[model samples]
Structure formats: structure tokens, C-alpha cells
Target: MKIGEIAKAAGVSTSRIRFYEREGIIPAAERGANGYRNYPADLIALLRFIEQAQHLGFTLREISEVETGVGEHIVSCTDALAMLAKKRDTITALIAEAQDRKRRIEALMAELEANRPAPRAAG
Candidate 1:
């Protein structure tokens, strides 16, 4: 398949595919005699996986690191799950920190309000 064909099938832009290739997130496409990139048909599935992973908060670096028989995106569901769990843990911690900060801010606001002085009467 051509770059545009795969991009259309993957619901991503052609430049995104090119960017992935450049970033080593996906294998580089083979160039044809006419100088057009010829991508493997299986690449569409990989592209979709990449998009879904990004949507689920997986970084490109993380996705690229998934090891398979071919060395990327085939042999390791466990690795992907581990990455998901790690991301979930990070997000959970951030949420807890944010809640703590909010509680402290609210308490400070109440204390300041309670200590505020009465307004002076108009002259």
C-alpha cells in the first residue's frame, strides 16, 4: 500500500505516518522505483494501534519499545498492559495530589475570610 492509502485506512494523516517512521515508532516504508513509499498492508493495523495507544495515554516511546518476535508490536501484550498499569498509577497519584492541593487552598480561603475585617461605613 502507498503512504496515503495506509494513512486513510488508519484514519491518520500522511505526515503522521511519516513522522512515526522518522521517530522509529513504526518501521520505515520501502521506496519504490518511482520514489513513492510502499508500506506493508499490515502497517495499517500497527498505525491504528499507535493511535489508540496515544489516545489511552501511552507515549510513542512506550509504544515503540514494545518487543515482539519481529521486535515491535507482536509478541507482548504483557508489556503493553504493564505500561497501561504504570500510566494508571501515575495518573492516580496526580489526582490525589491535586485533591490535596484543592483541600488546602479551600481551607486557607476559609481561614482568610473568617479573619477579614469589617468594612468601614461610608462617609
Candidate 2:
């Protein structure tokens, strides 16, 4: 598939694909007639994975490192799993904290409502 087609199918722009190519995550595109870029069909999946990883809080530099196995494989599958577990735990903790906060706020609101002056009926 061509770059534009891939971008449209991926719901991304051509410049984004070019940027990813420049970043070395996606493989370089093959140039066709008149300097048009021809990307492999499989790249669409790779690009979507990149998007998903970014959404999961993986930095581009980190993703690049993970992709290239750079600096002696600092990130392993086990390590990634651990990190994800920790993130999940943190999210769960935050939910609990939010629930507590919500309870306090609700209680405070109820107290205020109970203490408020009642409306006076018109004569």
C-alpha cells in the first residue's frame, strides 16, 4: 500500500507515517515512480501498535529502545509485564482514593444541605 492509503486506513496523516519512519520505528518506505512512497501492507498494524503503546504511557524514546533492543536489552518481557502490573495497581489505588474523596465530598454536601435555611413560603 502507498503512504496516503496507509494513513487513511490507519486514521493517521501522511506526516505522522513519515515521522514514524524517520523515528526508525516503522521501516523506511520504498520510493516508487516520481518519488512516491510505497509502504508495506504490514506497516499498518505496526503503526497501530505504536499508537496503542503510546496511549499506554510508553514514551516514544522508550518504544524506540524497546523496538531496537538498544543498550543491551534493558527492557524484557518480564520487565514490561511488571511495569504494567504496577501501573494497574497504581490505577486501582487511585480509584480507591477517588472513592474516598467522593464519599467525603458527598458527606460534606449533605451536611451543608442539612444546615441550610429552609425556603420561606410567600404570603
Candidate 3:
């Protein structure tokens, strides 16, 4: 597939595809005799995975680690599981912090409402 075709199929921009190539998130494409870039069909799925991982709060460097590991046979299942567990713990902490902030805000709102001044009567 061509870059544009893969980008559209992956629901990302062609520029993003090029950037991914530059960033080593995706492998470089093969060039045809006519100088057009020919990408593998599997790149579409890879790009989508990148997008989904980003949505799930995974950094490019983190995503790259997993991608590189898969390609190199370096990261074992135990390693992958540990990485996921760490990320989950971070997210859980963030959720707890956000919930705490929400509770504080709600408490402040209630205090303000209770302490509101009485309305002035008309003359």
C-alpha cells in the first residue's frame, strides 16, 4: 500500500505516517523504481495500534519500547506484564488524585452555598 492509502485506512494523516517513520515508530517503506514509497499492508494495523496506545496515555517512547521489543524478541511476557502493571498503577493514582480534587471542590461549593449572604429587600 502507498502512504496515503495506509494513512486513510489507519485513520491518521499522511504526515503522521511520515513522522512515525522518522521517529522509528514504524519501519521505513520500500521505494519502487518510480520513487513512490511502498508500505506493507500490516502498517495500517500498526498505525492504528499506535493511535490506540496514545489514547490510552502511552507515550511514544513507551510505545516504541514495546514495538522495538516485539521486533527484536527482547521483551518477554513477564516484562510486558510488568510494564502494563506500572502504567495501570500510575493511572490508578491519577484517578485517585482527581477524585480527591473533585471532593474538595464539591466541599468548597457546599460551604460557599451555606455561607451565602441573604438577598437585600427592596425599599
Clashes of each: 0, 0, 0
Candidate 2 — which residues are off by over 4 angstroms? 5-33, 40-42, 54-65, 68-76
lDDT of 1 by residue, 37-82 (tens): 9998888778888888899887888778776344346546887678
Q: For all the candidates, what are their Cα RMSDs to the real structure?
A: 2.4, 5.1, 3.3
Model 3 per-residue lDDT at 108 = 100
Q: Residue by residue across 2-87, what tens digits does model 3's lDDT show? A: 88888888899999998999998889999999998999876776787788879888899998888333342334678657877989
Write the candidate numbers in order of decreasing TM-score.
1, 3, 2
Winner of 1 and 2 under lDDT: 1
**Candidates ranked by lDDT:** 1, 3, 2
TM-score of each: 0.87, 0.59, 0.74
Better of 1 and 3 by lDDT: 1
Which residue pairs collide in model 1, if any?
none
lDDT tens digits, residue span 1-123, model 2:
888899987778899899998988777999988798998776766677667768987678756755323333334688667767876787789899999999999999999999999999999
Output the lDDT of residue 86, model 2.
Answer: 70
